[model samples]
Target: MSAADTKAVGPPVPVPPDPQPTGKSSSDDAPRVQKRKRKKGELLPYFLILPAIVAIAAVYLYPLSKTVIMSFQDMGRRELWSGEPAPWVGFEQFTNILGDPEFWWVTFRTIVFMAICVTLTMGIGLLVALLMRKLSTWVRLVLTVALIAAWSMPLMVAASIFRFMADSDYGLINTLIAKVVGEDWLGHNWYLNPVQGFGIITLLVVWGAIPFVVVTLYAALTQVPQELEEAAALDGATAYGIYKFVTWPVIKPVFTMVATLSVIWDFNVFGQIWLLRGNKPEPEYETLGLYSYSKAFESTSFSQGSAIALITVLLLSGVAVYYLRQLMKTGEVE
Candidate 1:
């Protein structure tokens, strides 16, 4: 305990203060890290969707934009003398389409054709789908294969086959009719009359369209909850009643989708008509679709043809908007 020893010992060492964070607590730091990770995770989804968005913009939007632009310009064989730069004729094409009696006639025919084809296809498809649901697995498989085979056939090939079958001289239809009616069925052309031609076209279109609808409806039907159906049955409802109350409501969305797709397809129908009637505007059976093709290629009125196409687009778009609104309302109700 000498003075020298006490001085050497000095005061007890002071404890060092804990280090402080720059601006954040440990808890705050944890949240920041988590937020950064979440931001990264959110970006991954957009990156995945970017390719699809780009592809759609390139493929669909670009062509649609071109069509819109072309529809506004008077770029036809007759209009070439106007200038290298086709003059902007605002809505002249639209006005022409509206004014033309032939356009109106074709539009009416198109609507009637679409209505008949869509109704028949949907009805037959639903019936077939219902039948499919009750079938044994093997039978269902066979039927599905057969249906897909029919659906997978090339459109041109199908049309050619149908044309052959419908021919006046060598057609299976005529042969069958002769066998039954004891007359020369091959003496007259089936497609010479507009009504008969349309009937045959309707049959062909319906046959081609039904397979897709059947597949879609059947998938939707199978997804219906068995529990709901059974509960419906227990409530003393008949089979039809159960279906009406329970199944139909469940399948309504799918029905709407099918109907919308069918309408679009029907509006754009050109191949079938072209195959049946070579480019000529039939006296009573010209559709807007066929009319557009004939104008563009056969008549060589590109601007007018483009105008017809735009009119068809507008018509279909109106229909689509109506159905989309209905679909949205249905979603809200559900």
Candidate 2:
């Protein structure tokens, strides 16, 4: 064949230019493989958290179980002195508590107190957080520190101070009231009146609890993307409309959490009532917390007190679970 024809109709043979080694390491590949290995090794974090889980179970669950068991037993000094096995009395304590008129009254009072404290705390906290959001950083920090200082003070100390301040004879409040409303105010015994006493306790509780709600709500408020609020503003939404639509929806979960926690804390309150009212059942303001303590310590019905305590725990747990489910729902939506 001619050279041109041979070139145009060449044989279909492939060209072998380079030979590469198989199963050989490359410099760039080593770091990538090592990074993958490092990631696989990082599963130890979950194991490290196991200790905290065990500690919580030991501290809270163990005592809760013991309390539940003791609620069924006739546990008291008499049982201890006799050195005899206390017989199991299933549901008797619960029934006695349920049947008692005083229990219902105390429970209602507790509900009212919880409602008042939770509402006031959440409302005031949200208001303060909104106001603080507009302030300078230094002012916000100072106010936050002051609120936390109030919250960090011991509950007993706060209750004692409130009690002293409300005393008709020597209380600073009474002195001020006397000056404003004349000397007749000095004769009024604030502690002796159930309404007045409960009102004071409610005020103290609200004051102490506002800090937690405020801090939590403030943090949640800050997390609300500023862009969203700006967009709403551009859309000609009113100030209240922006809050209701953009700001509130973002912080609703935190609000729910704070409210639930406030309810739980208020329902379980013991210090203020005990410090103010002693063991006597105030006809208008007796709370289940005080009633339970009185039942167990004063009346020596330990089983009944345990039953009441368990009921309180169950109610609070239900509330916590409900709100947690709501938080989870919010997360899913986001």
Candidate 3:
């Protein structure tokens, strides 16, 4: 071939060296690498919550376990002071408490009291919330302030004030009643009758609880669609009917939650009764908490007290589970 016809190869174009390769395909390794990273990310959340979990276990779980253990033992002042293991009675404490007529009566009283307080709290709270919705800006502000004040008052202080108001001598309420009814109300003991005494306590509880319920319900109410309410009204629905059809459904979840909470709190009422009855609540005033306290401290039956408290916890747990189920049904909880 002629030199002019020869093509220039340029040192054979230096063929690129074969790309280096690992034993594994890159695509196959990708997923495994991603999985390792994902696992590391997942662990971060649990690590972040570890402190909270530890605190809860120490504060709540520890005491709860101790109470459960004590319930099965014959722990008394002796064992409590000496820090010695009490004799294990193995459900005898539970058996005795469950079999006792007084225990049953106390439980019954507690349930009744809880029902009354919850009903009144829910009813009054809802009414107040509705009223707040209708109120002008200034009136609602005033009402909110009043509610906050009531809610901020300490429980002991509220109980003491109620007790003083119901005092046999020189009580403001008695003086007002005497003047209004022209009857000899001064020096009249309200605690002489159990029914009257409990009624007063119920009032005190409802008063303190209404602020929270009203605030929560009112917040929920504000989120309700006014257009729906107006449409219902235009369809010839009464106010109550409009509320039932449009308003209630929107606030029902909140209402249910608050009512359940009220049941829990009222069922555990101790301070109010204790203070109202001069710190020595009579047999007639014995609810589950008072009964438990009396059994533990007054009679030095710590095991029986623990058993009663455990029973109360079980009862409250049932209420809590029901509330959780309701929330789940409403898609408010997972």
Best by TM-score: 3
For all candidates in order, the CA lDDT equals: 0.85, 0.84, 0.91
Tens-digit lDDT string for candidate 1 (40-127): 9979989999999999998989767766876787777666555577778888887887898988888888988999899999999999
**Candidate 3 displacement at residue 30 in angstroms:** 10
Candidate 3 residue spans exceeding 4 A from truth: 1-50, 330-334
Model 2 regions lying over 4 Å from their true place: 1-46, 278-285, 330-334
Better of 2 and 3 by lDDT: 3
The CA lDDT at 296 in model 2 is: 78
State TM-scores per candidate: 0.83, 0.82, 0.85
- Residue pair clashes in candidate 2: none
User: What tens-digit string does per-residue lDDT give for candidate 2 at 168-188?
Assistant: 788888899889989988857
Q: Is candidate 2 or candidate 3 better by TM-score?
A: 3
Q: Superposing all C-alpha atoms, what RMSD in Å does each candidate have to the true structure?
A: 5.1, 5.3, 4.6
Q: Report the lDDT tens digits of candidate 3 across residue range 91-116.
A: 89999999999998999999999999
Q: Which window of 10 residues has the lowest lDDT sum in candidate 3?
A: 3-12
Residue 279 of candidate 3: its Cα lDDT? 90
By TM-score: ranked, best first: 3, 1, 2
